[model samples]
Target: MNQTYTIKEKTKQIFVLLIPILITQLGMFSMVFFNTIMSGKYNSSDLAGVAIGSSIWSPIFNGISGILLAVSPIAAQRFGEKKSNEVSAVVRHGIYLSVFIALAVIILGFFFLNPILNKMALPARVEKTAFDYLVGLSFGLLPLFIFNVLRSFIYALGKTRVVMVIMLMSLPVNFFLNYAFIFGKFGLPELGGAGAGFATSITYWIIMGMTWFIVKTQDPFSSYPVFANMREFSWEKCKEILQIGVPMGLSTFFETSMFAVVTILLSKYSVTTIAAYQSALNIVSFLYMIPISISTALTVLVGYEVGARHYKDAKQYSWLGVLLAILIATGTGVLVVIFRYQVAGLYSNETAVINLTANFLIFALFFQISDAIQATAQAALRGYKDVNLAFIMTLIAYWLICLPVGYLLAHFAGLGARGYWLGLTIGLLAAGIALSIRLIYIQKRKFTHIQVKEVV
Candidate 1:
């Protein structure tokens, strides 16, 4: 008789798998928070610039990042099949494609920057500042591209801890760069929003360099193929990456663009409101890193299990990941509700900013459960290589359901900023339900078919 792996062993493996990812997420989120705080301190307008600027570019980068998802599955499938050289080829192709994608975005972004900003209807100052920030931020695009390739490679090797280490190294460097540029500390000239942009650009290169170094030195299990001179790029592999990646990228872009659209709408309000909204958002965004980590881990595990033909285990691992995400999100929600004021105070000293941020933070707490559920489910879907479905679900939830409700609540109902928060809640709730149902149906069907075959 064959022995079955115990539940404890499974749980332990999943936890161990997730821990490194969680640490990496936290470290990266901390760097983001540092930038936000630095911008806010320089001026509220600067903070708004970061928000708007990031919104404009995030979607494009997200689409590129989506392509990297192909690496994990392709690498994992090959790893499972014991096709070692093919795994290296996949990673090599992923890096080459990422560089091309990044360069394309950079070139196009420069040409499109003015038009996009104009369409956004940003205030004169905010628009100009954001334009400069984005253009300067564009310098880091190549680095971001390289980092994604290397990071995905690390993830495929299951040495996610390296990601944690690299991010850890980046935190201090990011802070020091922000400090130097923001305040002209240590003889650095004050660059304001432009300074922030330059600081971030430097940080991106540092991260990429460090991650690449790790790939070369520390990780002996990597499949970095030698295609530098002799190998021609494969359109077939590129097409496969695009098929999975384009949808995933569009999903992130759509969701992020929704927030950006709302931010533009909010710009019609006082700058104080935008500042408050950004602060609250920054805090919530940090908390969200937890679920994002779980999702990343789920994607890896689900892909591995599916490739290995462990139908039951795939279903089990995916659900367990969701459960774990919910528990973490719930605990975070409770803590946020309890210390909403203190958390707000950390970002700004203004009474109005603090009050408005605290209120939104309360609303943010209400949606944490659904947020966790949806994020984990989406990750599981990605793991299943069902990227297109995930894209559609996000579209319907945000564009059809959330945006409409938020507009109605904010404009028609006079909820102001509160209306936007309420709208976000509705959208997240819809996404959570839809994604969960999708996962459950897929799991049940797969499991039933497996059981039926066993009986036969």
Candidate 2:
């Protein structure tokens, strides 16, 4: 009876955390959904421009956010250990690091953006709009990184609902600004595709502001004093975060950059092909919120259990999170297969783009399954603080397997855009399998250590 109750209780806890994180994930992606939708409506060139811009931005932005996500597991474990002061300290240093990293991204790094697009030999207007969109996106980089830090801190506290609500609230604001700036409505300039980037920047700042205010004023959050009596810069804390974060960030960057590079490579194809790729990629990305959110929740839950020294519970949470993610992906995959055409139409009225994307949705179905397994598995590993090896595995999957195979297939095999999607599928499957094995090893090693201690 107690075992049954515990399973039920853990399932309930996962769902409770999962739902808000899911909605919050949806809300975050909806902003981009709006961006793609609005840009596609303007024209194919505009859409392609925005697509390239987003392709460049998404992977790097996510990489940095992944780094900042160190806050989630670290803060979660601290919270589980009831070290509130330590939690406060983590948040402080996190904010400092976020600032430094944001500046690096804005100034020193990502120089690839300019030269790569220039070498692509895109139409002048498309190239110009891509740069404009990136310029606008740069404005929000600082705030967005800080907001991610705060969001991780909040999630670690099991206040997933709070971030969900804030993200949901930002949607309409994002939509209105997107509309205004895209079409010259409400005194906003018609910057064409560039407007989408500007809208995203403004929306990010607004959401960040909103989150900052709530964290400052809210009850449980207010008690932590994230900003109060801030300690001097601590290299130890920053290095600890970097040790975990740099590898975690690279893993995600490797995965996302696979897609980014694929898109860039596809740019030489007809505008319709690249545009269709983005259309298909967009809907699947929106659906991706499910597994990714589950992954986020698992990181927090597993981190908490590990910190509390509930080794068995941590293992249970890992498997449960992966199971829930796969089950949800299965259901959604069926629906995507059913409504692929209709969903494709939502991106653009172009018949060619819609038809190509409909066919691509079949491959995207496979993406959900592999991504569900791999993403949650990776998150669980993060909970174990076992990130470096996991990073190497993904590097092998994405760089060695996915990228080379994709380039060869697309160029040599005449598979075009479809080739890259196939490569992604293989890479994700390999990653899922490898990460699962890693998790099993970590679980057994921990249990063995525990048993040895008991024997002693």
Task: Report the number of the highest-lDDT candidate.
Answer: 2
In candidate 2, which residue ranges exceed 4 Å CA deviation? 1-5, 39-46, 109-116, 185-190, 265-277, 338-359, 406-419, 447-456
Span of 10 residues, lowest total lDDT, candidate 2: 447-456
Model 1, 274-359: lDDT tens digits are 99998888788778888887887778777766665666777787888899989989899989988999999998999999998888
187-219, model 2: which lDDT tens digit per residue?
878988899888989988998899999888997
Candidate 2 versus the native: TM-score?
0.89
- Residue 265 of model 1: what lDDT? 81
Error of model 2, residue 179, in angstroms = 3.3
Residue 349 C-alpha lDDT in model 1 = 93
Q: Each prediction's Cα lDDT score?
A: 0.78, 0.86
- Model 2 lDDT vs. the true structure? 0.86
